[model samples]
Target: MRQMGRTNRARYLATFLLGYALSGLLTGTWTSVETLMDYFKYKPRILCVESKTKPYFAICPFHKEEDLLVSGSIRDTGIWDSDLTHLLKVALSLYKEAMLVDLGAFIGYFTLYAGALHHDVLAVEPSNSSFKRLRQGLLLNDFSATIKILNKAVSNKRSYVHMGKNQKLNLGKMHVNSEKDTDDRENALKNEMIETVTMNDLLEYIHVKQAIIKIDIEGYECKAMEMSTAFFKEVFVPFIFMEWLIIRTNMNSNETACTWTDAKRLVDYLTGLGYTPFAYHPVFTLLDPSAVLDWEIDNIFWQHKNAKSLLPYINLLRKVGPKYFDKMDQNQV
Candidate 1:
């Protein structure tokens, strides 16, 4: 009996040790596989395996499939900016055959699409790296002549300004407070001395009577709006889609932290501009519009007051499109 007991104990110990070793090996293998998949998922690939069928598919440098051009190019490395493609679609719907200005044109994804639709677009991007990608995309998509690609940042004043990190890629921060002063960095790499043009300047240069403007400048949206105030008064940009978010980031010398601007200021500005704010997702806002909703980070379609005539199109958009409605119900309330 004693001999049998000893043998069983030895077998049990060996089995336990074997199981532990197997678990470690399996875990390591799993981790390696996941890492490999992730690396390939974001690596830039040829979006076009076949030319004719893949016109719309460009390998996303960020997403690995040229499915939707997220940032300035496929070379960008960051989380996807969900609003870029959707906003482009919305703008295209409104200005199918009109002239448009794409302020902060990162990789020219929107510019290329707008130009493809045969709409004259003034694609303005401030980042040299991002602009290079934009230029490549325009050429690859054959939109060089269609789009007037400008490598400059638009601001209230025409002078040199600093370009921030990630190169026009959406840092996911909402509303740059034009009213509030941010920390000035003399050593930031993304800084540039591009020509700052106002809406008036754009009109003077482009010689257009009306336009559809899409503004997506990291957090300097309010500044852009302030600069465009004159143009808004003079010209007839009936449709304007601006990025309004509540961004949390380190500011004031990367030491201070704050929740940038709440959506109210931009909404108020739009309201003041005689544009009615349309919430992107109504279902989320239907629950409580006053409460901060996160279903749609980007709120769009602040049309001029007289542009209410376009409600049918708006309604159609909400019905058949990817936008969230009831978003602006709180503004009404």
Candidate 2:
């Protein structure tokens, strides 16, 4: 009986140790696999994504594809900016044909979409990697001939400016640092010098009689607006779609920060030029600029006084609902 007890004890100890070793090995292997996937997931690739409008090929970074473009149930459904695209379609329907200026065109989703719909598009991108992808996407979708590509940053001036430091993990956050006030050497070292052009200069070059302007240049919208105040007064841009950011309350700099003050100034400027602001909450509703408290949403549309006749169309958009998905086929080039 004593001998049997000793053998059983030895077998139990061996089993416990073996189980612990196997668990540790499996855990380590899982962690390594996850790390490897994260590192390689964002490498650039060309993917065919089905958009709400039409099927198009997107040259997407692994991060954007995994996180934003393909996160939902449908792959590359173009739902990422469905609201903006829907609004664009409504605007185009109002005007038989119009020119679209996609400032900060990124991977040219909006730019290529506009071109695919037979609208003339001016797509601007500043980052080298993004620009290359935008160009590739345009070509992939056969929009190269339809859209004019500009590999430069948009600002209130025509000069060379330092591009924002690249945050490899989040390329969309890349912005231009015009202030040059940061003391971080590492951040400064990451900046690349890029050509910048004013909205006035670009419009002059394009010479479109009336166009729809879409601005999504991070937080630089105010600066671009400030520089193009004269152009706003002189030209007849029927629609201005922009992403507005709340200004840093702590910011004491005289530079444009798209803060409340900057937003107020923009309101005054646009209203002075007979333009009205409306918030696009899936549907266009008149926006009281004074009531806006934060930059929580991404889409705002400004209508020229001349385009007030299009207000009824807003209700039509609301009534149509998800049926707009079918409209994409109707509008496809």
lDDT of 1 by residue, 1-333 (tens): 011134433443344344434545765523234432332332223121111111232211322232234532333422233344444444555545556788877655556656655667887777665575565455344454557777776666655554433423343222223333333434332443345555556766465666788777765555566656667766677777665442212222232222224333545666677766555543312212233334254445566766424455445554665334213121221
The C-alpha stretches of model 2 lying farther than 4 A from their native spots are: 1-45, 48-52, 55-76, 166-169, 181-191, 233-235, 246-256, 282-284, 291-297, 328-333
Q: Write the per-residue lDDT of candidate 2 for residues 1-333, one digit (tens) a residue.
A: 011134433443344344334545765523233332332333213332334455332333334433343223124344456666766766765664678888988777777767766788888888877786576555445554567888888876666667777664456657887775343445544655677778776766465566788888877777677788656655568888887642333123565456666767767877788788877775466777665564355567888888735465566667777465445453342
- Residue pair clashes in candidate 2: 42-62, 42-63
Best candidate according to lDDT = 2
Estimate every model's Cα lDDT from 0 to 1. 0.49, 0.62
Query: Clash number for model 2?
Result: 2
For TM-score, the strongest prediction is: 2
